[model samples]
Target: MTYGHAHAEHYDLVFRSRGKDWPAESARIAALVRDRAPAAATLLDVGCGTGAHLVTFAKTFAAVAGVEPAEAMREIAADRIGAGQVHPGDMRAFDLGRTFDAVTCLGFAIAYMPDTAALDAAVARMAAHLSPGGVLVVEPWWGPEEFIDGYVGGHLVREDGLVISRVTHSVRRDGATHMRIHFVVADADGIRTFHEDETNTLFTDAQYRAAFERAGLAVTRVHDRDAHPGYLVGVKG
Candidate 1:
């Protein structure tokens, strides 16, 4: 399947399957960004899945907007945050013809870009939407080396007494990581199965820094938190 269609379908399943963890995680990431950003009046959230981070930031910032490529995800986000706030567009090509004090792309959204060229293009696109001295926060995917072979992680969700179990596995090879996720949901309607497959390049720290510099942004700091893999913040000169 094409990336767009696959992403849209995957996003629907993910949100339905993992809605519980989103709010707290998004809030924490927002706090981190707010600490580094100026008293900004506005913020833009790229890949703002389900408006989790975007809505949270809107509560504190003067204005908050989001760009999400998946229509299903955008619909869910708009329902929570209002229709005017979220736009359906790709992270690499969205243009609002305006700038913001802070730009954020969390949840390892950068990994979705395919290659260094696409990653660079996305960073440059984001940079163009940042005001002078603004901050661009990027959360990249973990390198393939970090994945443990033959290991698995899974979660069980019980909402309104309906249970769903989602299991994930990571397989690494050829300088890439392939993640396969399986979901089994049990409801009044009976059992249902959903499967998703995603791939991310095993990019190194140096490669990320190079991309940031090439986009004319200076890497100010790299933070590694125990809770999350962490992020790199770049400042527009």
Candidate 2:
């Protein structure tokens, strides 16, 4: 399940809540768009959680919309970019009945797909919504070749007399990486704890490119040596 309904509320608090530089990330995305789609105006971001990208892209794009599957995430995104701009939907089969100059499925959204077939369907859906000459940028999950199994990490954050902590352990199994995360929240309301499980398909670059090509999109995959996991760029012709 995505976000577990309750996980969404605590997600920002535990993960991006502590000094996360959203502006810098948005700026980086903007720069990428400037290079690939300097003239692109209308953009659609699938799985746009919390609206940081939408708000920043609004500075450059004339019309922007976001598609998020989780209601809680959509509510927060609506608050950030207005309710009209954030739609309730998923990447696999969401169609707004209109096209966009740029379509993106970022923030490891593609990783959530159960398998490469689902990933292909999601990419095709994103490609279907792109206008001619439109740009498509997808931030993928860790390729099986690069993923380190049995990895573990944790974080802690304190705010408004409330403390939130999270610990995650990842294990690779049968072409998928299973991430088990546990969260603890302490405040005047009392102490509470919960855990969430996320499974990401270990899709390779070749698989992603094949999907894009099947959708009739010219593909280019680029990986950052130190920064991002990598992005699969496609252009609709």
TM-score of 1: 0.86
Screening candidate 2 with a backbone cut-off below 3 angstroms (N, C-alpha, C), the clashing residue pairs are none
lDDT of each: 0.76, 0.84
> Relative to the unseen true structure, what is the C-alpha lDDT of residue 166 in candidate 2, on a scale of 0 to 100?
88
Clashes of 2: 0
lDDT: which candidate is best? 2
Clashing pairs in 1: none
lDDT by residue for model 2 over 1-237, one digit each (tens)?
A: 467656777766665665556666666666666687778889899999877778888887898999999887889889988999999987888989999999888878888888778888999999999988888988888888899999998888898898888889999998989999998989998999999888888998889899999999999876765346867889889
Location of the lowest summed lDDT over 10 successive residues in candidate 1: 1-10
- Each prediction's total of clashing residue pairs, residues at least 3 apart in sequence or on different chains, is 0, 0
| RMSD after CA superposition, every candidate | 3.2, 1.7
Q: Candidate 1 at 60: error in angstroms?
A: 1.0
